[model samples]
Target chain A: MERTRKPQQERAKKTVEAIIEAGFMFISRQSKETLTTTKVADIAGVSVGTLYEYFGNKEEILDAMYARFSEDVTAMLREVTPEVIRKTPDQGILHILQHLREMLSRDNQRYLHCAALLSQNLPEQHVAPIRQVLATLSLQYLSRNPEYINLPNLPVMNYIMTHGGIAALVHQLSSDDPMVTFDELSQGLATMARHMIEGSRRDAEQANP
Target chain B: MERTRKPQQERAKKTVEAIIEAGFMFISRQSKETLTTTKVADIAGVSVGTLYEYFGNKEEILDAMYARFSEDVTAMLREVTPEVIRKTPDQGILHILQHLREMLSRDNQRYLHCAALLSQNLPEQHVAPIRQVLATLSLQYLSRNPEYINLPNLPVMNYIMTHGGIAALVHQLSSDDPMVTFDELSQGLATMARHMIEGSRRDAEQANP
Candidate 1:
């Protein structure tokens, strides 16, 4: 069934929010594999029929959760403005990393579910906007730094490395048998980002000179 | 359905080999989602019943293919002996990276599938052995280098960094719109590995001295 018409009324909106909250709470407490619509309804203290009224299925509920997550992350990314990057690149990197770490640590199991969904070959509609936002932000940051200006395809490189690196680190951090402490993983990746930028700058200089 | 008994006769063994070869070929040619027993049997020039006689389902076929891939990778890792590592740590690093690049480039789709499976919270029985083998190899390489011996939790560090880095790179490389060329990615990662090892050694020296 198609998703129930968006909850427009105040009461309906509260019901939707409750269901989404309950969905994320369930994800945090258990693996995605164990989640069921009935369980979500019970957790939300709503009728099963009411839950179905909003979400067509569990996957739809996950899609909604994922959209919320993307919005949260994108909002966080917005805080890393050009001014902040220009003032202190290192601090800016740390800020982003710290926020990400906190987000992942908040509910690691839920984060894993989000990771799995994001990592899949999601439709362009679901993926493109977030990637565009990230790429645009990375471009802004790179352009502000003279050293990074000459790096070939700086925008794409920044997007791939930063996004891929973050995804990998998050996956490791969320795993039951994480190898490194959170501090180590974050520091290591920050170091990597710094070095990659510097390394490419060096390469560009040698090639041009 | 229960999996077929292991082939005891030479002819039956050949049939199983043919089926597995067909399975990998299908995976390489198309996404795993599209693979089916009938298609695999057709590709292998075997009856559908014969395919079922050897494998319980599509997942079992994937499991067999994964085992084969693991064996191939483990064999490559075995070649990174103490002598090779001691002779030139840089060369050993490049060797491993080159082998990984080749394996990934050989069948990008299949590699992605394997990565997804391995990255997930797979059963300990399925994950532990592969991880143990990789960790052992990483430990061997790290220990043979005197500078790395003093690094904190060297074995675990090696495992996490190496595995995480490889996974991140593979994901990027296999992507449709890859950010960096294969040469750049391999070089960048090799540089990261070298720096991380040397950087840790420097820290250790500073702390001890």
Candidate 2:
């Protein structure tokens, strides 16, 4: 009985993984227009019924995929080393840029296309998970710097950097002819981060004085 | 003969204006999904064929309406007083915010709905005019600050801010629950503009030193 149950559970987990992977592939390849349960099931090597059994429908699968992707991003953000945070703003920015370059370069089209679809299609209710992905990454960045705590509205500033910075980068990346090159994008972000740090430092000094 | 023809031409212009105004009203009252040539013609008190005679299609009418809207915005931006630009960052931001509030508040649905429709439905070719709109505004802003001319790769920075800034703002404003309020959004842009100015200043001082 135990051996039969173990095999069944493992098979179920594999099926779910296949479904999620297939959904991501479909979204990346066909954009949002082709995101139907039938196509996903066909891509996953599963029946329509099996797909429905695993996920209520297409939206449910997408929601699960969104949650998983957001969680992965949060996990990556938390993995930033303490030494990286303690470095000067210039050095810290370099490390952050390096990480972003590696991640985005690995799957540029997939990530960029997915982001475009989300920006276009996702409802207000769905925005929170995406925003949380951003807020979590930002909070993690700020956690390493105690000096910035006393600065006026640290979270608002960080939100501007992460959300606004990423928003700008994504728009350029999605454009037919990107004006900002990959290197320039990274450097620009580093510049913004450094300036923001410097501005907060000035605020901190003023508050202390 | 010339005087008689002038009144005829004037009558044609008035008819076209009536069609466009009715089209705008139709889209504002009904959703974009429901907007059609027949419906617009019915509202305009013209035949469907007459509406098509002027517009050729729905997109052409939309383009006309958008062109008018852009002209209004351009006139507003062009009117930015020298004193407004010379003010402190926070105060300058507030000035812009007040203007934005008035523009956005009046017929909020019109701009919001049209923006949503364009980002999703318009083809790649349609984006060029809007991009030009952004470029013109940036050029006007840059020309105001002659000091920024000598910066390395200056056009690239302006492109980032104007193209990326407009894209980010539109996407956020279109979202279900926007991340930034009008005041916050305007201040965020001001902070970025101020930082860019300060960074350029530092670069100049360092270069000359």
Candidate 3:
């Protein structure tokens, strides 16, 4: 069974990748209404039967794309060590925001469009993985900073405010004619994050002292 | 024309009010999919023709509801004078958040569900009126505080950050069993807003000094 399954496993992986890439392409160039499975299968150069063997439907394919995006984000975030955060929190945050902006802006802003579409139908279960990854990274950053360690429920707070605020700003910026430049948007988010960190620290200190 | 129109005018006014009220009731109690004009007319004790006389379709009824919500929000914001902001920005923000929470949470979370549905299909032109009102009020609040005056493009910044952030939080909180309580959410938002205000002030002062 093992000998027979290896080649099939490799082929399945390739098909899945192709389907996701095709789905992203369609979502970027076409409206959400146009992203049907048959069209995606045609774009991927795979048979409709093969596409069904992998994904149950269009939403399933979109979910795969979303998961792929989340993995990419998590991999990038892993590089932001505690040391980088300690030396210069502002630059560290700015760097992360820049990376996010680039990821979301790739391929003539296809990722943003796809993300918007996927988000509308995202199940509650799908939100947890991304949120958990983000919360973990934020907690790691805060834990490295002596001033921020003792803040009550720091990870949860970071998750809600940072994720929620930046996600909102990104969605707004993804529009055809965003009011602020990417630079301004990123800076605003960084400032908000810094304030949340510092404010929590101050509050904790005041309460204890 | 005037001699014959008086009674008709009063009857028309009452019918319009009844339709609007029924629309709101349906939106609050039922999902958007269930909110048909036929149902609304039935609830309002009017014919479908009369409902159509007042509203073109379901979207038109939803739009009317949104307008009413906006009017209520504007009236509340109108009372938040610069003096109120000056005395205590944190409390002022908290008060606004509470008002927003109350408005969104009304009628067993009907307003929020209706808002989510309306926002999904909201036209570009429709967004402007509400954004304009929010920007004007934020500008008034900032103008009263000398520290915030020197920030570049203050009105636009306020619009993007305040609207984007608060809208995001509201959407998250609208979900059942939200991770954070209203108190925590409001405090977190107030903290972020204060930081944005103070952070910008510091950046401006440092640049000039």
The candidate that achieves the highest TM-score relative to the unseen native structure: 3
Listed in order, the DockQ scores are 0.19, 0.18, 0.20
Local accuracy by lDDT, each model: 0.65, 0.64, 0.67
Clashing pairs in 1: none
- The alpha-carbon RMSD values of the candidates against the true structure, listed in the order shown, are 5.1, 7.2, 6.1
Candidate 2 C-alpha error for residue A12, in Å = 3.9
* Decreasing TM-score order of the candidates: 3, 1, 2
lDDT of 1 at B89: 53
What candidate 3 gets wrong by more than 4 Å, as runs, is: A1-16, A45-54, A81-86, A105-109, A112-125, A152-160, A199-209, B1-75, B78-87, B105-109, B112-128, B152-160, B202-209
Runs in model 1 with CA error above 4 Å? A1-19, A34-58, A80-88, A105-134, A147-164, A194-209, B1-5, B9-58, B80-89, B104-134, B151-160, B197-209
Judged by whole-model lDDT over C-alpha atoms, candidate 2 comes out at 0.64
Q: What digit string (tens of lDDT, one per residue) describes model 1 on residues B140-171?
A: 76667565666754544464455555555555
Clashing pairs in 3: none
Candidate achieving higher DockQ, 1 or 2: 1
Candidate 3, residue B82: lDDT: 48
User: How far off is each candidate at the interface, as Cα RMSD in Å?
Assistant: 5.2, 3.5, 3.9
Per-residue lDDT tens digits for candidate 2, residues B1-209, read 22122214777778788887886788666756688888888888888777766676677787777666666655555565454557664466457556755775576556665555544444434444555755665555457756666775466556556555555566566666666665676676677666666776676788897
Which digits, one per residue and each the tens of the lDDT, describe model 1 over residues A1-209? 44677888999899999899888788766756688999999999999999888887777887788777777667767865654567555466667778766665565446555554444323334544666776776667766766567675454446445555555565565466666776666566665555455555655777897
TM-score of chain B of each: 0.79, 0.75, 0.80
Candidate 2 docking category?
incorrect
